[model samples]
Target chain A: MTAIQISVFLENKSGRLAEVTHALAKGGINIRALSLAETIDYGVLRLIVDKPKEAKTALAEAGFTVTETEVIAVAMPDRPGGLAGIVDLVTRHGLNIEYLYAFVGQRGENAVVIFRVDNAEEAITALQEGGAHVLSAAELSAI
Target chain B: MHETTPCWNREMEFMEEGHLRPLQSERLRDVVARVYERVPYYKEKLDAAGVSPEDIRGIEDIVRLPFTSKDDLRDTYPFGLFAVPMEQVVRVHASSGTTGRPTVVGYTRRDVQMWAEVMARTFAAGGTHIGDVVQNSYGYGLFTGGLGAHYGAELIGASVVPTSGGQTKRQVQILQDFGSTVLCCTPSYALVIGETGREMGVDFAGLPLRVGFFGAEPWSQSMRQEIEASLHVDALDIYGLSEMIGPGVSFECLEKGGLHINEDHFFPEVINPKTGDPVPDGELGELVFTSLTKEALPVLRYRSRDLTRIVTEPCGCGRSLRRMERVTGRTDEMLIVRGVNVFPSQVEEVLMRIEETTPNYLLVLDRKPRGMDEMEVQVEVSERTFSDEMSKLETLSERIGGEIEETLGLRVSVRLVEPRSLERSTGKAKRVMDRRDLGR
Candidate 1:
């Protein structure tokens, strides 16, 4: 299964993050993984959500600037190197990982790992062509 | 030999009576010619009026030159008014950009000395002397009030506590522990300090403060009286503009009649803001200044939008240079709310008169759902008024609304907010908020 990543820009101010989070919650979108990068004026709220398309639509309708990027979601053993195996494969394929985080589905049988790479499309193509089980949005939503 | 007592005020007050007038007159003529020769803006303006720099022979010939207004300063931007090279300028300060872009002004080392001297004289007028511990609450950096007061206190050999504005309770503690004798800040800040001191049960009456130099905004005599009674000190108003020089341009002595214009450094004239003609004594007009001794950025008849009457009457303080009444209102500060001309000073005056309300207030101009303009005056009620019955609160609000309607010729909704509901300004309080069409 792959990790669905979404990007949102937020102005820096008190309670601004709360406003966005509350808006997304009202839309019934659950965030699996999140990372926030910021500068003086604004921050980019990166999220791996259960429903990427619906979450992007909800946030855009709520007046937030959102961007989506394809990220490699490699299933791990839920133990050590569970994810390092994928890192080793990507490194062997001459790919660089920009950022990565992990999330576990409700089933608890598998670990869903998220990856931000310098070239996301190539990483996804290579991982999929390499016969890795890259989960689609439908499979993730069902999980 | 003992050190001589620096008569910082002498150059501004008594210099014309001695040899400073001739020196100023000669420099004034030379400066006019130099500006005509070097600065294109001054040259074009003066030339268009068919006036020659050679025509200006003395101080009396100043009327021939055109008046310089804030618009001129704005048009010039950072260095439009500089007569000398930029490298010679020792420091620069600017007016707050509330209306538009801020007007920039510069000074040389000698100009800074004059500023310090002006402030020294102002401090001395309020009875400041050696060993007196002065606490300065004016906001520092880029703004002239704090540094100006600091230099004056330093020049007078007074022990100064450089506690810039804010931290109200700590300010009271410093007043108690440090035994600060003289306080320098805006009149509004002094009132806030008094209110805060009362809340903390500090014996404000037991404080060592004997005098307060309050200015940088228009404050009424009623306010002065209230501040004096609360803080247990005599209140003196100091007046100056950044375009002319900072706080040391003029100050009120013990006389309390008006602010004495420091004629040695600044020459003040009251001219009609619209007509540019001199107004008679006691008539309210815009203040115009000519920096007789300012070296780096000398302005000739620069119009300060501040509206006040100039008084040449002999003051008991013995400084004969002229006095200007406390500013009534500035031309730029007049607010046209819902077709009624309203000045924030009038609202402040009304609030001060009401014993139940706190001096802090905000004028909120909002719009209705129907797109019609409406105004709300959110005045803070004192703690004593807070526990009053609902009926009493309603009556108080009605009374304030009626007075505002009467004074401003416009109806307004008055809301009596809780005590300390309105935010306290560490520097100048922005009293008006125009939210109409703001989002658009």
Candidate 2:
């Protein structure tokens, strides 16, 4: 089960991040979660928006370098050790997590976390075998 | 008292106008006759223009010869322009054309000898000696810059380091370890070398590197200052094209005022690009060259699209060869924005003078709804130039726009782009993007 994440290239100038958020807001698209990898001159803004396809199109129309990536979104308990239970399964299976970020305000009682692993299929299988509920693109977007 | 620079070929370089004119005339007459009889391309061009060998009796009558252009070179593909048999031709060089086939130039044995002498004179003018180590960084192979500079440095008795472009880190180490005295490469590569040296902690000012012969692309004077300051070497602008026998066609002497043409071998003229009439001396116009002594391929009044002014004033270096200002810009590269001429170099000169901006930039042209062609300069913002507020960045953009409009007298839009987004080309960098075709 893979969820799509929208990535936008943002120049490290003032009000650029705001412009991206403003464009998504204008398109009536909601951002679920975002992680900004910043450099000295520019930054890659990774967004897990509610509507990935429309977000990509809107941000691109706004003159941005946008790319859609598949990330594993797994549901887990909101407690601190509740996340370690899912992390231990992937670590025990030798799965490498490239990057991960947690966000609030999604559907269901459990919290949602986005995971970009080096090998997504193996990570999903290991997590599923460990009884972690993996969310699909539809289930995540519907939230 | 300090020692003065010496001429490589004293007899020819220091020849008085009284003796040099007739020599030039005699050679011009012979070459004109040779091309007329041998090369079918020149033959047809000359005959159509109602010109004959007798019409060109002296250097003053050079205008009688027909002008050959890149299109002419393309028409006569690979070996079409060779006046001599292929067996007699010693070497050939080619430059990639924007179209499919490349423009090829061939040189006979004697022609190769002439190239060596002129290139040697170029090095001599730069004060290169047998003791100095010359590191040649221009790319080797089909390109003429590498081999042209290689043969010239060898002819001048200097030890050669043939490190043809790329591996900039290795180049810096060679500069430090080999104790090279002279550096050769394009101005852009020189910047890369300086930056790479800083990264590697190589102190260029402490090294023995002295003079640099930079060419193969059009560069601004401010770039010279940047390279000189960074590499701690005196950078001299070398001018040439493959069609004109590569990088030795002309070179700036240590005097550094302008490049002196090897007039005895190659004749030069400044012409008004629009009317094709010879512009008076010291006036800006398109430059044209007519090879006086090339045997295998004798170019008769080859129209070099480079724009510059010629000065006949005496050079302090004691060479009688006429001087040309560093090429300002190419006539074809000139962009007409809403009826005004905009040069990419003018923008480069402006960017180089500014402290907050990097030289890597692109000029994009598009047509607005009212049919007005708009030009937007995409400038890469570095960390130091970047600000936390959007208004500050817009202010920087406005300042850039204001400065460019002040120089070109045309309003332009400035866009801030991410660093390293602009393409850094190994060869000639294409800076302008014309999207007007899509606009139309």
Clashes of each: 1, 0
Clashing pairs in 1: A1-A135
Candidate 2's residue-wise lDDT over B338-418, tens digit each?
888677877886887777778779999999778889999988766454543334556777899999999899999888786
Candidate 1, position A50, lDDT: 76
TM-score of 1: 0.59
* A28 Cα displacement, candidate 1 (Å): 49
lDDT (tens digit, per residue) of candidate 1 on A5-98: 7876555668878977887898898877777765453455778777888898898777665667666677666777667777776777898776
lDDT of 1 by residue, B252-310 (tens): 88879988888767877887666688889887667888887787787888878788788
Instruction: Tell how far residue B429 is off in model 2, in angstroms.
Output: 4.6
lDDT of 2 by residue, A74-107 (tens): 8898877878898898889888776788775444
Name model 1 segments beyond 4 Å from true: A1-143, B1-24, B333-440
True contacts kept of each: 0.00, 0.09
> Per-prediction TM-score, chain A only?
0.82, 0.94
